[model samples]
Target: MKKMFKLQWLSVLMLAFVLVGCGAKEDTNKETVSKEDQQVEKTSYKVKDDRGVEVEFNAVPKTIVSLQPSNTEILFALGVGDKIVGATEFDTYPEEAKKIERVSSSTTFDSERILALKPDVVIAYTTGGDDENLNALKVLEDAGIKVFAIKSATSFDDVYGDIQQVASVMGIEDKGEKLNEDIKAKIAEVQAKVKDVKAKNVYLEISPKPDIYTTGSGTFQQEILNAANVKNVFADLKSWPKVSEEDVIAKNPEVILTTVNYTENPAAEILARDGWNSITAIQNKAVYFIDPDISNRPGPRIGEAVELIAKAVYPELFK
Candidate 1:
C-alpha cells in the first residue's frame, strides 16, 4: 500500500509540473500581447496647424473634409484624395474633387451636411481674424470631429508649411517633403535659366477695368514674381492694393501679367483699355493671361505658376 501511494504521488507531481509549464507559457503569451498593444498605443498623430492650434488624432483619418480648394489640392497631391469625403464647391482640381460632396461655398458653410457626412477631420482656413466660419467649425468640433485651420499663406515657406501640416494630419509626412522638394527644384531650374537674364519690371493684375487690383510685397504672388526673376512694379506697396490705371500706366511695366479670368479675353480687354496706348506691355503685346486657379492657389502647383510667369515674362529663355 505504501509503494502504491508513492507512485500516485509521483504522478501528481508530474501533473503539477505540466500545469505549471502551461501557466508559464500562457503568461508569456499575455506579456507578448501586452507589449504589442503598448507599441500601438505609442504611435500618435498630432500636428500644429498654421493657426497655431494643436490637432490630435486617434488614428489616421479615414474621412476628410477640405473647406478650401488649396487644401483639397494638397490632399489630392498627398495621395489621400480617396479619404476626402467632402470638399468645398470651389474645389475643381484633380477632376475628382468635383465629384466629392460639396459642403461649403465661398461665403456659406453647410454645417448640417458636413455633420451628416460624418467626416473624421475637416481642413479649414482663416485670414487671422475672428472668422465666422470658425463658429460653424466649432459645431463640428463639439460633435467630436477634428478641425484644423490653416492660415492664408503669404510666402512659399508658408505654402510648404501648409502642405506639411496636411500631410502630418494624413500620416504621410514623407510625401509632403518630396512634393515640396520637387516644387523647389522646378523653381530653382527656372531661376537658374533666368539668373543671367535681366529682371523685367512686371505689373501683375489680379483684377482689371474700372477698379484694378494687384499683389504687392508680403504676398505669395510677389514671391512667385521674385522667383521668376521679375520685379513687381507694385512691390513698394504691401499686400493686395487697388491701383489706379493712371498709376499702372505710370509704372509702365515691361510685362503685364493678368490673372483675371472672369472675362473671356483678359489680354484683349487690357489692350482695349482707353488711354493706355503708351504702356510698354501693351505696345509690345506682353499682356499674358495666367490661369488664376493655378497662380492664385497657394498649393502644390505653385511651381507651375512660377514657371508660367517666367515663360510669359521671358519666352525666349524658357524655350
Candidate 2:
C-alpha cells in the first residue's frame, strides 16, 4: 500500500509541472503580440514653406472652404473639388465649382453663413484690398475654424509653390510635387523658344468699363508678362493702375491682351475706343482675349496663363 502511495505522489508532481509550463508559454505568446503592435507606424507628412516653417496636418481634409476664387481653382486642379464644401460666389471656373455652397460675391462675404459649413480649413487671398475678408474669417477662427491665407504669388516659381502649399494642406504632397515638375517643364520649353526673341511692350486690360484696369509691378498678371518675355508698359506703376484712353494711346503698347469677360471682341472693342487706333497694338492686330479667371487667379492655372500670354505675345515662337 505504501509503494502504491509513492507512485501516485510522483504522478501528481509531474502533472503540476506540465500545467505551470503551459501557463508560462501562453503568457510569453501574449507578450510577443503586444510588443509587435506597439511598433511606430508612419501615416502622415510634413510641409515646409519658403520661410522654412513647417506645418503638420492629419489625413487629407475631407471638408474645405475656399474663401477666394484663386484658392478654389487651385483646389480643383489638385483634384480636391469634391472635398471642398464651400467657396466664394466668384469661383466660376471649372463650371462644377459653381455648384458648391457660395460664401460671397466679389469682395463681400458672409461670416455667419461660412460658420455653418464647419469646414476643416478655409483658404483666402489677402492681396485685393479685402480687409473685410480677414474680418469675416476671424468669425470662423474664433469658433476654431482653420484659416490658411495664401498671399498673392508674384512669379512663376511662386505659382508652383502655391500648388505645393495647397497640396500640402490637402494632405497630398506627392501630387503637388508632380504638378510642380510638370509646370517647370512647360515654363522651360517656353523660355527656351523665346530666349532670343525681343521683349515686347504689352498692356493687359482687366476691365474696359469707365477706363482700364491694368496690372502694375509685383502682380500675378505682370509675372505672366515677364514669363512671356514681354515688358509691361505699366511696370513702373506701383498699384493696379487705372489708365485713361489718352494714357493708353500715349503708352502705345505693341500687344493688348484683355480678359474675355470684358467683351466678346477685344480687338474691335480696343480699336473702337477714342484715339486707340493710333496705338501700334491696334494697327498691327496684336490685340487678343484671355480668360479672366485664369489670368487673374494666382493658382495652379497660372502656368496656363504663361502659355496663353506667350501665344498672344509671340504666337510664331510658340507654334
Candidate 3:
C-alpha cells in the first residue's frame, strides 16, 4: 500500500509540472500579443485640417470619398486613386476617376448615397460655401465617418499646402513633397523661359457676355499671370469681380485670355464684342482660349497653366 501511494504521488507531481509549463507558455503568448498590439497602436496618427479640426486615424484610410474635383485630382496624383470609392460627378480627370461612383453634383450632395458607400473618410471642400453640401458632410460626421475639409487654394503656396495635407492624411508625406518639388521645378522651368520676356497687360475672362466675370488680386489665376510674366489688367480688383464692358475697355488689355468654352468659339465672341474691336488685343488678334480645367483647378497641373499663359502672351519668346 505504501508503494502504491508513492507512485500516485509521483504522477501528481508530473501533472503539476505539465500544468506549470502550459501556464508559462500561455503567459509568453499573451506577452507577444500585447507587444504586437502596441506596435499597431504606434501606427496611428492625427492631423489638423484646414478648418482647424483635429482628425485622428487608427491607420491609413482604406477607402475615400472625395467631394471636390480638385481633391479627387490630388488624390489621384498621389497614386491613391484605387482607394477612392466615391467622388463628385465633375471628377473626370485621370480617366480612372470617371469609373468611381459619383456622390455629389455641382450644387448638391447625396448624404445617403455617401453613407451607403461606407468610405473610411470623406474629403470635402469649403470653397463652394454651399449649405447643402455642408449639411451632408455634417450628416456623414454624425454617422462617425471622417470628413476632412480642405480650404480653397488661392495661390501656389496654398496649392502646395493642399497637396501636403492630402498626402499627410493618406500617409504618403514623401510622395507629397516630391509632387510639390516637381510642380515647383516645372514652374521654375517656365519662369526661366519667360525671364527675358517683357511683361504684358492681360485680361483673363472667366465668364462672358452681359455677366462678365474675371479673376483679380488674391487669386490663383492672378498668381499664374504673375508667374508667366504678365500683368492682370484687373489686379486692382479683389478676387473674382464682375465688371461692365466699360471697365474692360478702360483697362485696354494687350492680350485677352478667356476660359469660356460653353460657346463654339469663345475667342471669336470676345473679338467681335461691340467696342472690343478697338482694344489692342482685338487689333493684334491675341485673344486666346485657355483650358478651363488646368487654368482654374489649383492642382498638379498649375505649371501647365502657367506655360499656356506664357506661351499665349509671348508666342515669339515661347516659340
Candidate 1 on 45-72: residue-level lDDT in tens?
Answer: 4667655666777666889988778888
Predictions in order: lDDT? 0.75, 0.65, 0.75
Best by TM-score: 1
RMSD values for the candidates in order, in angstroms, are: 21.3, 23.5, 20.8
Candidate 2 lDDT, tens digit per residue, 1-319? 1110011111221111110000000001111112432311223544443323343344446798886666677778777788888876667778989899977654355666667788777765443333444555556677887676655555666666677777766655567778778777777777788889999989878768575667789666677788878999999996467778788888999999887463578767876777678889989988888876666666666667788888889999866
Candidate 2 lDDT = 0.65
Clashes of 1: 0
Work out the TM-score per prediction. Answer: 0.85, 0.76, 0.84
lDDT over C-alpha atoms for residue 15 of model 3 = 17
Give the better candidate number (1 or 3) by TM-score.
1
Tens digit per residue, CA lDDT, model 3, 101-126 = 98765556677777788898998765
Q: Compare candidates 2 and 3 on lDDT and give the better one.
A: 3
Name model 1 segments beyond 4 Å from true: 1-44
lDDT of 1: 0.75
The candidate 3 region of ten consecutive residues with least summed lDDT is: 18-27
